[model samples]
Target: MPPYILPFEKPILDMEKKLEDLRAFSQAQNIDVSFEIERMQNKITEMRREIYENLGAWDKVLVARHPQRPYMLDYLAAMTTDFTELHGDRVHADDRAIIGGFGWLEGRRVMFIGTQKGRDTKSNLERNFGCAYPEGYRKALRLMKLAAKFGAPIVTLIDTPGAYPGIESEERHIAEAIAVNLRDMFRLPVPIVVVVIGEGGSGGALGIGVGDRVLILEYSYYSVISPEGCAAILWKNRSYANRAAEALKLTAPDLLKAGLVDEVLPEPPGGAHADPAAMSATLKAALLRNLEELDATPVEQLLEQRYNKFRAMGVFGEDAAPAPAASPAPAS
Candidate 1:
């Protein structure tokens, strides 16, 4: 009944509305409403299943960046018991774009690092709209190293458009900072689990994305470049972003098929924003499952596997080699 509802949520909401109307009508007429309610309930269930089962790539992107989708802080509040945030990169002012510190999830001490995008306009501006700066990446590196030293397994929630590309960030060496984090996280002597909780754009996501096990939410995306950027580069037109999105294979299922992500964590019907609590419960269970498995493995083995996991990505077979430009046909 609400305006601006996503297409995937429309059918489910429609079923609910029908059930309500049926109840109201039956109550006014003093007739049996139970049968009608049951039928509507079945339709609701069927619609939910069908919608989620056949989400297209663009629909998945919509879910991933859903305005109400559970962000990092939402997940932390729902799942963590005690959270004390640590701040500062030590060499510069604090970057609100990143939040990291120690937290207790399911009674286990874990270090959490994540990009935080605010929920509304004012807050979004304060958080740089989820774009990390050089200092933010540096702060993440500090927390990661501390977690490794303290023997706490690391959990990183990735949700960013990309790192900031402002002149200030460039002056501060954003690229170098991101590169350092990528290098350090790869060999950290501890278990690292990364969840692409939302938008995962370019190097900003990968800077802190190294993990023993990498999981992507069913609706989240991970791409070397955002669709807009890819379109501008490949088609010389920003309007081709939709086409680029289709060609880039940036959705969770696409990444899984490409061997880029280890697992896909299912979201609530519609998206995580539909039910933050339920989404958090699902993610908490997923983390616990992987942590248990990682806990049982020898630390050395875990590190080796993590390293090998990344090494195996982007491997191309002989068919991957680009063919020489086709020779022009003989002149007519």
Candidate 2:
């Protein structure tokens, strides 16, 4: 697929195109325009910094949804030595939307699971655009149990917009499946680390999201609903998605500040899609570091910590006592 560019990234692309054309022209004419090429390169570098540094919440949403951004399979391939994909909930058909397996993470045996999205129309249809049904959550819970049974740590990558909202999903009791996973994950005996690699939307994300450490990529988001979904409900128009995104507190920095996530994993300067290799390396290091920390803690303490971590979320400030309304404004 061709590179997917966000609207605000146009300036950087424009400069890059100019630089490319200049290099081509100089080479074709056998001219030594080294000074011009170097100048253009420097200018493009500065432009990239300026644009990426000032990205708005909506811009981040765009980045998180970028098709070229690395997916779960991409990261597994880059970070793990060998992977054997496990499928199905065992009671139902295998859900392609949720994939899990055992992998060697730098020689350490670990169970890896994640929401899977596709790159094209046919694949998207097959993956159901990463919207898993009840069976998908069931499969994820099964994998988590298997990991716990073997005393292997679990790592889950999240990037789905949501669970499938079609009638078939309702008929299968999607809510109950996710609710069961949420309850079961807290009691599991192994370390579970969850990462929001991209679109962490609604119950779909939380279905497999409970963990000892919850991390989010710099340009990724974890929201109760998509900005568009929120806009449609709250503002009566999807065009207010940008406003909704700002108000959602879903960005990595916002999530960190709100205590919704434990850490914010910084992505490549222009976004993960700009440099998948670097993003994968950063992700591998962070995962290893967190896993090492979790490994040191006793299993009992680990479970307590995981439970407490999520329990402490959504703490709200109490409203100040309303000054008695000045005794009804002296009705006399």
Candidate 3:
């Protein structure tokens, strides 16, 4: 299958194609071109570095949305053992977009939950392009409650454009489903770790994003609104999505600096899709380390800190307007 080429990746792809042709020609003619191949390889490395090193927020968005980027199941397979999937909200049908189950991470048994996006057209349709309905949120909460009941820590992977916004979603009360999760997650006794592994869009991501340690992959974005959605609303055109991405400060680094994200996990060079195994390893280590830290705190203290962590995120500042001095004098 052909790779999904983003707009900015065209140059890099062109260089790689030339390098491939050179190698093939050398082999066909039975000639030694190893020196040239090495030189070209070095050039390609620098090319990738230069491009990735200076990526803008919009560029990072493209990378985050890349079709081949590792999803929740990929991370689960890489980081856990003894995986067992649990399904259904018990009140509604099972939602495939948001999947959760029990998995052994490192030396401890933990509950794993995350939004899953599909790899192809068929799967995307099945996953509804990673948009969850009310049942998805309810199912996630059910899983979390189960984890808490078992005295196990909870790990949530977030990646979605937003909650499903179709008519059926409203009919099922999507907002209420997410609101309940947001409220209940804060009160859960077990430690919860949330990772924004990809496009963390609006209430979709937030439905299950609460936790003690909120981490984000370097290229992933977490925002109340997607850039395109914001652009369409604010600029009246989706083409201004790039500008909206910049203004939203949704990138991992941006969110970290703004105190919205606890930490930013650096992706493998050229982004996560370029080296999924490496990215997965980094994610595994981070999850274990954060989980270890949370485990050390008492349950009461953990819940307190978890609530405060999110509370602290809503920091607001309002400049008090100058009193109507002139009007007061006139009244006097």
- Alpha carbon lDDT of residue 258, candidate 3? 82
Write model 3 residue lDDT over 80-102, tens digit each, in one string: 98889999999978998999999
The weakest ten consecutive residues by lDDT in model 1 span 315-324
> What local lDDT score does residue 26 receive in model 2, on the 0 to 100 scale?
93
Worst 10 residues of 3 by lDDT: 323-332
What's the lDDT for all of these models? Answer: 0.88, 0.93, 0.92
Off by over 4 Å in 3: 318-332
lDDT string, candidate 1, 7-49, tens digits: 6687687778888889899999999979778988887877877
Error of 2 at 258 (Å): 0.8
Off by over 4 Å in 1: 1-4, 26-31, 317-332
Model 2 C-alpha lDDT per residue in residues 14-55, reported as the tens digit of each score: 888898899899999999999999998888778877787888
Sort all candidates by TM-score, best to worst. 2, 3, 1
Answer with 2 or 3, whichever has the higher lDDT: 2
Per-model TM-score versus the true fold: 0.89, 0.94, 0.94
Candidate 2's displacement at residue 61, Å, is: 0.4
RMSD of 1: 6.7
